[model samples]
Target: MINSKIRFVTALALAASATAVYSHGDVAPQEVDTEGLKELPKDEWLSENPYRGNKEAIEIGASAYNQNCARCHGLEAMSGGIAPDLRELTKFDDEYFVNKVRNGVQRNGMTYMPGFEDVMGQEAIWAIRSYIDKRHYEYKDKDLAELYEQAE
Candidate 1:
C-alpha cells in the first residue's frame, strides 16, 4: 500500500512538472504580430482588432449575441444566471474572451450556451467583442484610440 502511494505521488509530481515545462524551442510566449507591434498586457489584443470601435461590427455582434448568447449571458450582455455578464468581456483581452466562447461548455456553459466557432466566423467574435465594449464601457469611435492606451 505504501509503495503504491509513493508511486502515485511520484507520477503526479512528474505530470505537473512536465506540463509546466516551456522552452523557446518548444513554445515561447505568444506576442502580437500586427504591424510590427509588441504586446502589452492591456493593449495587446487591440493589435489585430479591427472591431475595437467599429459600429457595423457591433451591430453584427449584437445580432449574434441575441441569436446565441442572449439566453444566458443576457440581452445586451447582461447576465442573471450561471453565465457571467458578457459586458465584462470588454474588460478582458481578446485571447481570454475568445477561449471562453470557444470552450463554452467546458468553461461553465450549461445546455444553453454553445461553442460558436463553427457557426460564427472570427469576424463574428470580434463583432461581439465590439458590441460588448461599446455597450458596457460607453465606448465610441473617438474613444477607441485611447481605449488601447488605458491600462488594466
Candidate 2:
C-alpha cells in the first residue's frame, strides 16, 4: 500500500513540473495596423526604404516594434541573445528586410522565427525596419569617448 502511494505522489510531481515548463512557451505576436502610412505599390516591391527618416513613420515604427518584436529582438533592437541585434542592419536593402519578415527563418529542425506576412501589412513591417535603422545610426554616430569624458 505504501509503495502504491509513493508512485502516485511521484507521478503527480512530474505532471506539475511539466505543466510549469510548458507555460513558458512561445509568445504570441502582437497585431499592428499601418493606418495613416503611405501605401506601397501592390504589384511592385521597393528596393530601398522609402520611409527612412520620416518623422511619423519612425514614431509609429517605434511603437510597433516594441509591441511585436521587443521580446525576442530585444528592446530598441539591441538583441538580448535570443535573436540578432537589428542595429547591425544598417546597409541591408529593403527587399531583404521584407522577404525575411514575410517568410521568417528556420534552421535544422527548430523554428527561429514565424512569418508575419499574414498578420502585418507591408507598411508596418517597413516602419519597424526604419525604426531599427534609426537606432543603429544613432548608436553608431555617438561619440562614446566624448560622452564618457563628460561624465567625469
Candidate 1 positional error at 120, Å: 0.8
| Per-structure clash totals for the candidates | 0, 0
The lDDT of model 2 is 0.77
lDDT of 1 by residue, 1-152 (tens): 99999999999999988765631122211121122122224323332456566556666767766666665676677677658876555554677777666555553544445566555555666666767777667423346545544422
TM-score of 1: 0.54
On TM-score, the leading prediction is 2
In model 2, which regions exceed 4 Å deviation? 1-26, 142-152
Tell me, what's the RMSD of every candidate? Answer: 15.4, 7.0
* Per-residue lDDT of model 2, residues 88-116, tens digit only: 88645667777888788879977898888
- Report the number of backbone clashes for model 1: 0
Q: Model 2: which residue pairs collide?
A: none
Using alpha carbons, what is the TM-score of model 2? 0.72
